[model samples]
Target: MNFLVYAGVKLFTLLLLMLAGGLFLKALDRLIFPEVDFAHELREDNEAVAKVVAAAILAWAIALALVLG
Candidate 1:
């Protein structure tokens, strides 16, 4: 019962964190590229933009891992 409760809480927390991260990223996107349409780029399948975004995300992940480690 304790394990079940713990697992449920952990799942909820992770989902919440992911949503918050996405919102934060959106804000960052707007601030960094106010003139850019990230959604449009994604829709048009822009690989260069995608690659840059992916690299930014990976860098963030690495920094997060390092801090959390």
Candidate 2:
């Protein structure tokens, strides 16, 4: 139905927004966490940076969600 299609489109848009936000985070991660190398920490499986990145993404998602609403 139309509602189902609209929901699907919204979900897809959310997915894309998350992806873009993550990339934005990565791009700014260095300036934000200059003490740590984002890509290196990621490859070495560093939990600290992981959490920081997750938080940034969540913050971004929340802001985006608010705007979308």
Candidate 3:
């Protein structure tokens, strides 16, 4: 049906947008904290770094939802 096709397209678009936003955040993270290695911290079981990463992801998702809604 036409509705199914439309829904699929919208889902794809949303996925693309999320990918772009994540890449932007990765770049921004490196720019802001040049010395802090997020991957390394995460591998070493750093809770504080994990929390910060989660917070950043949640903030981005909320902002994206607000914009798309």
Model 3 per-residue lDDT tens digits across residues 1-69? 999998898788789989999899889879999899999999999999999999988998898788767
Query: Where in model 1 is the C-alpha error above 4 Å?
Result: 56-69
TM-score rank order: 3, 1, 2
lDDT of each: 0.80, 0.82, 0.89
- Expressed as tens digits, the lDDT of each residue in 3-68 for candidate 1 is 999878767766676677779989998998999988899789999988987897787667555644
Candidate 1 colliding pairs, count? 0
lDDT score of residue 45 within candidate 2? 94
Best by TM-score: 3
lDDT accuracy of residue 25 in candidate 3: 81
Q: Which scores better on lDDT, 1 or 2?
A: 2
lDDT of each residue in 3-52, candidate 2, tens digit only: 99998988888888889877777778767777878779878999997897
Which of 2 and 3 is ahead in lDDT? 3
- The collision pairs in model 2 are none
> For residue 57, what is the lDDT in candidate 1?
76
Residue 29 Cα positional deviation in candidate 1, in Å, after optimal superposition: 0.9
List candidate 3 segments past 4 Å from native. none
